[model samples]
Target: MGQGQQEQVATSLAGAVSEEISASLAPVDAELERRYPGDPGTRQPVHTVYVPGDAFAADTIRSWGDQALAALDEHAPNAASFAAVLGLSDELAEPVHSRVRAKLEHEPIEDLRVDFEDGYGPRPDAEEDETAARAARLIAEAFKNGTAAPYMGIRMKCMESAVRDRGIRTLDIFLTGLMEAGPLPDGLVLTLPKVTYPEQVGAMVRLLEAFEKARGLEPGRIGFEIQIETSQSILATDGTATVARMIQAAEGRATGLHYGTFDYSACLGVSAAYQASDHPAADHAKAIMQVAAAGTGVRVSDGSTNVLPVGPTAKVHDAWRLHYGLTRRALARAYYQGWDMHPRHIPTRYAAVFAFYREGFAQAAARLARYANRTGGDVMDEPATAKALSGYLLRGLDCGALDIAEVARLSGLTRADLESFATPRRGDLTASGK
Candidate 1:
């Protein structure tokens, strides 16, 4: 072919490929929208703290938060230096300091995940099943007594070949036991890890549907977050991205996409010594996840910084530095949520999050207001910008770094406006896990 003809042919092929993908997606897209009709909105938790299912207790997070604060006092150089690192003003520092003490005395855990996967490990099948049942009972009891964490869920092992049936059985036992105790608690969901095929997601949705039918619960009641841990999870057999396909397979039950740091890095052939949250491979996966889930209302969370803040023998400073840096990077990339592996990370998580939200908030809020009013000539306030700006403050409000009153004043938005921008939160921290 001539040069121009060759170029035209290449363009035709590209357009054909795009058209094929779109046509294949059309039905799934339509179904997803009809099932999840009005805006999917946002449900961004700053962090997910995973604990072994067998060890779960309603008050465990608060205990861990308290312990973290005590360690700070017994090991740190001075209160001021710690305050500086947390970016706490003297006034803010006092409250954070007191909040830690109070959180320990009260509710410490914000978002907790009971893990039957790596965190819990593979025990005897019967023993694991029993533990799942027991955890379910504990969670239901806490809900009945109005003591459950605001956001709580279970992380089962991968639903893929090797452990598929085991994961399903554990999930079935847990949900069955929990529902038997009482009504499903608000904000309960499942976390499906290492999803390498769309069929795995479809199977999970079908399983949840069965649970609802058996328990007389609503369909789509048990939503889930799909963990993108392997390269194959992102790459479909047809040479297209599968994030959308997995969410589509959920049939309106997929709530978020969570990246698995170490596993994803390993999948990319990274050595154990170099695998971290910000590894190139991990970031690439997260970026794809973010793009795939954007506008779909499927929240995207960066994986945890595995380096726990276990101390006395370890410098908390090093842990804090790593956590803070990773957090800031995630926040900057518009990924508001992440995972926390240690209780000592509670303070650092909040500190990093609050600092992120507080920074550029004033300027962003002002710009948002001007854009809405059509006074900021250079600023074109689009849906994405509005979501980002509002999310930043909503996170602050959730963390108590910014209150409704402050948000209204700074953003020129009303109480209802701010409230409407985000999901219903279990109120602010009370028992300070300082």
Candidate 2:
């Protein structure tokens, strides 16, 4: 067709019809944009390491790294031994093993949460207040000194009637200390645990708003994770999904929905022996949470395991296998993040993540390269698939599972290029028909 003919063929609908349709759907479009803005396109940590409030010290992060390395040294002792325990393929054994050790030695704790909740139990009001303030100061200093995790904050007590006032006071003290120390760190993260109702979420929103007003900061500057520990948080008594309501009630301050393994399991009366992240009840709850949080800029995190890797070499190896398998399963399901309770869990966590990303890195990079260049291959690609591919590579890079140089070498795309594809606007995705 001639250029003029092609120009004339643009958009079959009449101008007036198009305008009317757009005008009629304006509200719907606005709502869609408001509710589903896709991911926030930030770096999501692979795991959150929870340290008890009183136990968290200036050197806590480094201690965890050292302990993780010690665990590896005493148990696996070498790359081959570690790989054999996790059944890593020969191709991945060396790279994955070396990477895991390096990660442990360097960025061992991506996300650190000083737990003022179950981990702290019930401390006296004065003691709790002091501890919270101390935690704030330490976290602020750590971030300022460049020793903080990529994300660091506290998991405050739940909003239940019994602990509501205390939780509020503790959060206030912590935030106040942070402000006093310095402007809150960009990596600061807060978690509201055991959220059983949407109103609880609203309360958190109000609290953050008040803090912002008091601190003279911008409105909506604070966001917190809602810990889903109760069955009611997943399925309301009235037959609605309470977790969904919780997200809406946050008024965009909810950053995550973290499943609470033991608490959630016990809430449903699941036997202790049967309680696990892969349990049917746990999976059901997380599935609902995932659907509800999809495209809302809120991430979902799986809960932790109670099994600690502290025993004979054989027993530790068994625990490592269990943790590694669970991590792999969660990765395959696209969860990407979970909880690591003990320092010992770090090795397996990194191993599973590294393997998961490295095993498929070549294919994902090649596919994305093809999609970006519009080179047809054995498999036809769509924009959504391209988005997923880019996002996968981005996540791998974020958590140290994949390096930028290697990624660029294989994908022929820079980090910035990957980000562009990973975080395209909804309109952009539709307009760029691959």
Candidate 3:
């Protein structure tokens, strides 16, 4: 083509591109106006809670109740004490309920888990005729009397073959009965144990779907909390992929991932002499779960700190509590909520959560503030500066150390500035003190 013809074509192409860019900017401007009109500088705080589900038991209903009350009075004074209780059948429920009530009279509590059954393996033949019926009756009674705790929940058995052989059937019957008896409780978290693969999760999802349909409940009303107990679930050679697959398979059905530190350590042949929660095996297992759950909204919880001291002596017990605090903090830093198996451990639980967030957020804010001061331009140009600023923002957001707006304000940046720094060619920040 002649030079004149080629130049004309290039000019037309550039005009078309400009028009496309203009069209795209129009909606972006409108969205900015709708979401942040005259409020470009406004920042919002990120509210995040590190949920520690109860792995602790008071030994008896009375003691459990008393301890729960005392703990609430002590550590979670403003917050309600939450408990997860277990019962094999309806006959067992009343006895358990009566015990919990006596303790709560002194101290208020929130949350309860009426375990449908205990232990693993096939459900007993008696389970069908008696256990299921009795559990349903007791739950109905609890509902009618309004004596049941405010935050009530039910823990269905895990998805082992033995459970499928019996417990699954029992669960079907029990869930149906519970639905008919009253409104489904505040929430339902299927406690799946020994879940080795995605197919297993898929199985649970299917079952939950069917139950919801039968009960005329929302299709995804129920959620799951998977227990990463077995070595096979974490080790690649032993079907670790299955665990990752299972999580993906459950998709919207999963709420959280919990590490079974003791069980995982045992599966790895770690000596009984070692502390399960602190063992290297346990760390690796938790790291695996953390990596798997990277972008998934599902929360991850660490296993309980099983050591229970006789009494609270800050001098003697301080080391124990600190160690526990550090472990919980590490998990929290890794973005996993941890479990507190005993009430005395609550102090450590809250302490770790507070320290991790406070320290992390402050440090990130300081660093981002420094970067902001160092760079004056609306668009950052230095490679190292841009990378550090971008990384600090992302890590802060991931750990709940800083929200997007806070990151922007502290870094003297806009959302577009941070996003541009996140582009592949720019890369992540370099390690400090290297």
Using lDDT as the measure, which candidate wins? 2
For 299-354, candidate 2 gives per-residue lDDT tens digits of: 99998888999989989999999999999999888888999999999999999999
For residues 84-139, write the lDDT of model 3, one tens digit per residue: 11111343333333333333453222334445434322345674435555555555
Selected candidate, larger TM-score, 2 vs 3: 2
What order do candidates take by lDDT, descending? 2, 1, 3
Q: Which scores higher on lDDT, 1 or 2?
A: 2
The CA-based lDDT of model 2 is what?
0.93
Query: Which clashing pairs does model 2 show?
Result: none
Q: Per-candidate TM vs. native? A: 0.83, 0.97, 0.58
- For model 3 the local lDDT of residue 67 reads 60
Better of 2 and 3 by lDDT: 2
Model 2 TM-score, all chains together: 0.97
How many steric clashes between backbone atoms does each model show? Answer: 11, 0, 6
State the displacement of the C-alpha of residue 152, model 2, in Å, after optimal TM-score superposition: 0.4
lDDT of each: 0.76, 0.93, 0.52
Worst 10 residues of 3 by lDDT: 39-48
Residue ranges of candidate 3 with Cα displaced over 4 Å: 1-152, 236-240, 311-323, 358-434
